[model samples]
Target: MATIFKTDAGNYKALVRKSGWPTTTKTFRTSRDAKDWARRIEDEMVRGVYIQRSGAERMTLEMALKRYLTEISPTKKPTTQRAEATKAQQLISHLGKYSMAALSAELIASYRDKRLASVTSRGKTTSNNTVRLELALLSHLFTVAIQEWGLGLSFNPVLNIRKPSAGQGRDRRLSAEEERCLLKAVNDHSNPMLGWIVRIALETGMRSSEITSLRRHQVDMKKRVARLSDTKNDSARTVPLSKWATETFEAALNNPIRPIDCDLVFFGEPGKDGKRRAYNFNKTWGVLKKKLGMADLRFHDLRHEAVSRLVEGGLSDQEVSAISGHKSMQMLKRYTHLRAEDLVGKLDMLTREH
Candidate 1:
């Protein structure tokens, strides 16, 4: 049964109640519109297809994203939380006005195309992986809204939309000559710690955050291992340190630039309130890359180089994965780029056996 009444604000409010269905309500400017909505809802209820979509219809994308940021993002890793927060902001800017119920597969596909064609402030086009990640965040939000938040969405719009192809993983390993030049440039840099950071990265296939956030207590110089309690995969891992890595930490310990306030292995200067923070060398890294004329190289590529070297040195996939902190074999394979020249000797041995 449905009931219609004129509100004090001169709008008609319709309320529908059924035995098994949740009570549904909607407000309309005219009595006819309210009655029409009630009839449609009643028909759907009788057909057993009625889903309470009032929450989705009433809540805009902006509101849902804001709620997700507050309620969900905080529970994620710091790096993931920061990245998702940025994605949420971008989503709010693009399609925030539409209510969740109004966001269809077509609308999501349109947003995807628009984002793919968009350029960043740095004058570079957005990568497919970046757009893919944004879409993933939106997909997760819809899933949460439907499952947990009682939004009553029949389907995730993002699921039906075509996502940008992530393409192949980067295989930008440093050449022997390029590596020498890069190391020389790093050594010439004003900050002595910068060179050691680069050296450690090449020696051990650790992510930038994992290397930077390393605590003094986590490193066991005698054992030549660094135990990370918090990794991107939320799994604690112990990475074996190379002789060069151990030496670099030893030098950093004696360096005056290393802060005293924090136990951070690579600590930065004190802030306005005298609180030490993690060392940030992004600017210096950029300058060094430009000076070396390797603008295409990323700091992360050093990890790729390390992984490739490990594979070339005949380390098993399992051994390399343990050192690199890669949780999945598929992910570890992406980082491993073997050189054709390095395979020639193995190919020759096979010929001899034949």
Candidate 2:
């Protein structure tokens, strides 16, 4: 049974009390609205399909995001934590005021459309990949709320909305001239760490973060291997060091200027917390690239170049994946952009042998 009462503010309040269900109440603007809500609750109770939605109605998106950042973000990698925090701010700016119960698929779809059409502070149009990552974070938040926090969401609205397409992977390959210029610039820089880092990336397909965050003990010069326990995909891998990579690592590890207190291979200046973190050469990298007239070249392209060279050197896919730490063959293929000029030499050798 349900009861409708008139509030002092001229609104109608509906309260439902069933034999086997918890008491629920809601306020509506009109008596008709209250009556309709009360009837629905009672019918659901009778059908044993009633869910207590008061928690969802009271909690706003901003509140949920705050909780998620505090509790969930810390469990992720440092790079992921920073990225998610940025994405959370964007989501909060647009839809934070809405309660979880009020977020419908249509509303989320509108957000998606608006984000797709928006521009960033850099005056560039937002990429589909960026929007997709933001939506993925939101979807995961909703899932966590329902499954872990016991929020009374019937279904994830984000799941019902269409995700933006994952845009094409970058196929930028470093040319021989560009590589020569880049190496000369890095080697001539005041810091030799930058040069060693660049050489290691070219010789081994290691990510910038992975290269910068390496500790002395993780590298074994005798075994010619670098053990990576903290990777992007949460999988541990041991990377075989090429002769060039091994020499670079040896130079970097034996750096006379290295601080005794710092365990990082590429140590930055002490932060405000008085702790040395991974080397942050983003600004330096940007300046160097602009100076060399290769302003569009990205550091990650060095890894791509290395991966492509490995394939061209006649390493099998399985062998390359082991060294590159790529879990998927498809993703590994994306990193390989073979140059026709380089392949011509191999073709001539094959013809001579035949």
Candidate 3:
């Protein structure tokens, strides 16, 4: 309900009231002007029309971000937390100062354009991949903000914004000789543990993250299986531990670092806080690859080698899929390459049998 009042002091004024929102009042120079503006605004409200909200409000971008940050504190996965936090920081930098209701279709389009125009990591224009990643994070956050939090049910403007294409999956792989060379090099290195990491990568087609997060209790020598939970897809899986893998576990049991707590099988060097932490040897790996003139091969290529070898060993697609814990044949197919030599070998074997 609203009321129009005329003041003898020489000003015409009006008052507006709405449920769940504060009342607003304005003063106008003439009674005619006040009536016209009041009627127009009231009529729009009666018709359920949206008026763009501005200023620091409950649904402002900054408030939503603070809510998001406060909610993710219970998680302990450092890598996952770091990545998500970095993404949130990017969103705050991009849209934190704006009112949630004011993010219209046209303005979102403009923001997308500005983000895609140039990538400035350290104030210099960089690659398209950087922009693509940041935009993906933006879209994901807005999706959560609108759909999950119900910040503005009627006003999700991100859908109209076009997304840039994310490129193909990585295809870097190691041939048989290269795998042999890598194994030999790792074995001869000053770090004895490097060889174990390399061997485990070849034995289990697990990602580097999964391998690094391995715990002693996860390994079962009796059943010859390793239990892994919280993998890439957040799915739990049990994979076989080969004879050599079992022996590796036995070797680890002999060396105990700081009375093992919980299920941690492997721990990194102590941090400044004096707590043993799990570390990634990516830099050392990079240096080793560079020395061998095989720096082009990525750590993930080790998983590819494991898959390729399983195929070469005459394991059926299903057999390899079970060990690799791949949910779909599509993901498995990317690592499987057709070898002309394999076909030639089959032909030669046929001739010999005949």
Tell me the lDDT of model 2 at 65.
Answer: 94
After superposing candidate 1, which stretches have Cα over 4 Å from the reference? 5-12, 20-22, 29-32, 47-49, 256-261
Cα lDDT of model 3 by residue, 124-202, tens digit: 6544565566566556656777567655446556777776665565667677788788889988976656777778888
Compared with the true structure, all predictions reach lDDT values of: 0.90, 0.93, 0.71
Choose the strongest candidate by lDDT.
2
Off by over 4 Å in 2: 345-354
Query: For residues 26-63, what per-residue lDDT tens digits would candidate 1 score against the true structure?
Result: 99999999999999999999999988888899999999
lDDT (tens digit, per residue) of candidate 2 on 1-354:
899999999999999999989999999999999999999999999899988999999999999999999999999888899999999999999999999999999999999999999999999989999999999999999999899887788889999988998878888898789889899999999999999999999999999988998999999999999999888888899999999999999999999989998888999998899989989999999999999998888999999999999999999999999999899999999899888888898899999999
Q: What is the number of residue pairs that collide in model 2?
A: 0
Q: Which model, 2 or 3, shows the larger lDDT?
A: 2
Candidate with more favorable, higher lDDT: 1 or 3: 1
Highest TM-score scorer: 2
Which run of 10 residues does model 1 get worst, by summed lDDT?
253-262
**Model 3, CA-based lDDT:** 0.71
Clashing pairs in 1: none
Candidate 2 deviation (Cα RMSD): 1.7
